[model samples]
Target: MSDQPPSHGTPYPYAYGPPSYAAPPPFRIPDAFGWSWDMLRVHLKVLLAAMIPTVVVGLVLYAMYFWRLVPIWIDMAEPTTSSTVQLDRFQDLWATVGLLYAAALVVAIPLSLFHGNLVRMCLLIADGGTPSYRMILSTRRAGRVMVTTAVLLVAGVLGTILCLLPGIAFAAFSMFTLPLLLDRDLGTFAAIRGSFALVRAHLGLCLLTFGLLIAVAYAGTMLCFVGIAASMPLGTLILVYAYRSLQVTGRTV
Candidate 1:
């Protein structure tokens, strides 16, 4: 498929055909969820391997924060501490907190890169194409993926701050940015635009799929947060499946 967008009056490569008088097929949420679970079960080992770095990084950060805060809490709790000393310690603690946050964001860059590649791997699996570990970890398009992710994060944050509804709208619209960037090798902005166009073209279907996946993820979070180990990968598979469905039916722009 060409990376270039179709010109005015031209048909999109993945455009759906004209509709018939009959009703369209319904979005089967249960089937999609089941398919996600099946894919996760088949590739459980690979998915866990891919998630190791992220899980380790998170644990390390959490431990560091806990260790660092315990002493501060003890110091604050001491009635004998001088006001000046307490203020000085508090400033130091705040500075340390800022540094930790900066460090986390830096770590997140590579994590996002790996995640984008993992999404592509899932897409390949969904399409019946075998993808190797080396290919999945390859950095061929890491730059584009990282840039697109940063843009999405900023936009999503700004939209959420502006209004709750626009934030949800932006999140729903840009759901396919990573997949499009990986598969089409499009520029960051181009991929973002393509995601919006595609989701807009199939708004209702996209909304239902995205919402269901979000609901599943939320449910996982409620389960002492351990369920995310299963739900997160399942959500990714469902997304890749949905993307493939749209691609196969020429429903994506």
Candidate 2:
């Protein structure tokens, strides 16, 4: 062994936390390069683990709604009813179920966000960047993003109820909200408002980028679920970049 003292140094000199950068790039996420399959696969184990909580939350919400509402009206919903009773049954079927389901979903969105952020955090870590679950949790401004998200969700559901076409369009428009919210220090409302403004500002580009995502999703659905599990991550990563580009610079469609 050499008689030289090994120089002791911090793992990441001039940086904090792990040797990983752990923070987003200062400016913008690069186009077509923000995310990749290789990067995503490195994080799949994390994603799979995160999904357990999400699945559990979903099942809980479903169970809550089913148990709470089904017994209430199912007993009242007799098949052999007179014409007037049939009309009442129809009214209860459509309208009452609608209200109950809406209430159930209101409870579910935050749970879903929690799950999504879990995945997002893992992605950041796996991408060779150091980030924290604490920072991720702190990103939410409570009132801002949550309320905006809830409003938009209601609006989207309403749009879908109006017609399938508008629903598809609305869903497409909503593609970037998650990354935008997470990557920025945006309150819930600001993030949502910014998302809408960005989409409208670059309507064509937003539509096109998200359109490709839709096409991919459609193809994935057609090929059975394997395609979706593999492909969804890539598409989601694309959103991270796309949202960063739209917000960081006033790039037009």
Candidate 3:
């Protein structure tokens, strides 16, 4: 195939077999990050497609969390007839919340990495190639990235406590460590180095991608956090697609 899009303007490239279902095309990551508004307008449909499942899952998880709070609310709403019982309830609530938060890492940390790879896969499919969920699933098969995620998750929290700089910088620049590690089957230092290499020359694009993500995330939160379940996949797919595009083009991604 030619370096650019196919000679004909058909969006997809290969002659492939049936996908999961012949329903509609799955989501695609964009060719790269620095797309023109014109191009984005053209591909907005795929971006939306990439995001659907993410939003549904996020909404369901949120609903479950929200329901968990209902019992606490009911308890408080009941006449506080006794400060003793109220205090006991509050303690129990805190204990449960703490346990849940601690336990969540086992799930959340890995899911975080999966989410990143999923966006990358979307980009791959967008390039008129097959996107393999197995590619992403393979990344999680070993526990290395999972451990890194837990570390990063804590590092991220600690960074927040120390100063916003650490957190912000990690979010933008080092965000790819997990993806690099998983996709390339690299070690921690290697993944870190690879991520740095990937964005070394394109700091501006990386920062811009991060800025866009923050903007979208902010917008989603303002929408009663529906945006989280709503916007994350969409936001993430575009950014990942753009990044991969830049890298594959042998330009400073």
TM-score of each: 0.73, 0.58, 0.59
- Model 3 ranges off by over 4 Å: 1-61, 67-100, 132-142, 197-200, 220-230, 245-253
Give the Cα error of residue 209 in candidate 2, in Å.
3.7
Put down candidate 1 lDDT per residue, 137-170, tens digits, no spaces. Answer: 7787888778787788778767877967787889
Better of 1 and 3 by TM-score: 1
Highest lDDT, which number?
1
Instruction: Give per-residue lDDT, candidate 3, residue 87.
Output: 95
Give me the overall lDDT of model 1.
0.74
Q: Across residues 50-163, which tens digit of lDDT does each residue of candidate 2 receive? A: 444445555565566667568657756556647887776667666767777776677656754553565366336534464443543544445555665686688778888887
Model 3, 1-253: lDDT tens digits are: 1222211222444468733322222112233333323333454555445445556655666666667767987887788678799999899788767665665655577475556555555445545555543554445435776666677778776786677888777666666675566556778767766777776766776777677777777888787566564456546555555555555544432
In model 1, how large is the Cα lDDT of residue 185? 81
Residue 96 C-alpha lDDT in model 3: 67
* Model 2 weakest 10-residue run by lDDT: 1-10
Q: Count clashing residue pairs in model 3.
A: 4
